[model samples]
Target: MASPIKSYVPYSIFLIALLLRPSSLTTAADFSSSVCSGTLDPSRCFQVIKTIPGGGQAPSLESLCGTAISFSLSKGNQFHSYVQSLAASASNPKLKQVYSSCAENYDDFIGNLQSAQVMLKRQDYNGVSTMASSSMTEVDTCSDSFKEGSVADPSQLIDKNKYYYTLSLIILRISNKLGGAA
Candidate 1:
């Protein structure tokens, strides 16, 4: 029979190689699909993620969550500023009122997102989800205000609101997947 030590040489090398390797190596596409899997609309989630700068290459699930919250915050701030400018410039009293209300809504939305950012830093995924849901409610309230006012929709304002709501849903769903704190 072959010597026992010689028989085990190849097995030992193989085990060593396995131990040295990373736990799992997944491609960016794999990461995207997995990260987007549990969302309300996986397809939309993937598309939205891809639209964010460097989003497609998120190295891990937590990083993906960060990307979503950070992008939403940035977009919320931009929308808030836009609404404020609209509120200032709108000549029609009804339009001005709608814009002013939207500005306030955006303010609350931004606050929720800011809170979500903190929760994300703390790895409190549930807390982040709650904040995202609250942010979505703000958007919904703003949309409802528009419908109630019957003001002519400003160029892209309504569409942006709808899009942000969808983004908020994405954030909430993704955060839910992580469960509670790490």
Candidate 2:
């Protein structure tokens, strides 16, 4: 027969290992599916979020918010650079003026996103929503510049801006939900 102490030692080690292992918690699929359920493009939302580095396992609401905020910052910076380049390259003074406005608009957009990120970290849902909404308006401001100028809209820029705006909206919505839950 096995000694009682030896039998207990194996069981104790097993219990210790189990206790030390991190909790399964939430998977990325679970989080993305739940988060994207109400969005217009659930699949696109899931794909965009899951593709972020370490985003495939969003263990908490904070993790999801972080990923969204990071993506928004990246997109905002890219848009700012693109508009700056457009302003620099435009030969027509009128077009150059509009592009310069766009560049400034993008600067405001990035500022809003940065504000939203800070609010998110502080768990200030109302502030996050306000900042994100403001960022969306910045995109509209840029688009309207072309409309008011009676020039063709920059389709590519508009599309990309919309995509980034949608991501910000998603983050805002999630933050609101978390606030309500709290």
- CA lDDT of each prediction against the hidden true structure: 0.83, 0.76
Q: What is the lDDT of residue 14 in candidate 2?
A: 94
Cα lDDT of model 1 by residue, 38-146, tens digit: 7677887777768767667777667877887899889889989999999999999998999999999999999998999899999898899999999999999888887
C-alpha RMSD for every candidate: 4.0, 6.5
Worst 10 residues of 1 by lDDT: 173-182
Q: After superposition, how far is residue 29 of candidate 1 from its true place, in Å?
A: 2.8
- In candidate 2, list every pair of residues with a backbone clash: none
Misplaced by over 4 Å in model 2 are: 1-24
Write candidate 2's Cα lDDT for 75-174 as tens digits: 7798789889988988778778888998998899889888888888888878887887788788788877887877654436666666666776667666
- Judge candidate 2 at residue 148 and give its lDDT: 83
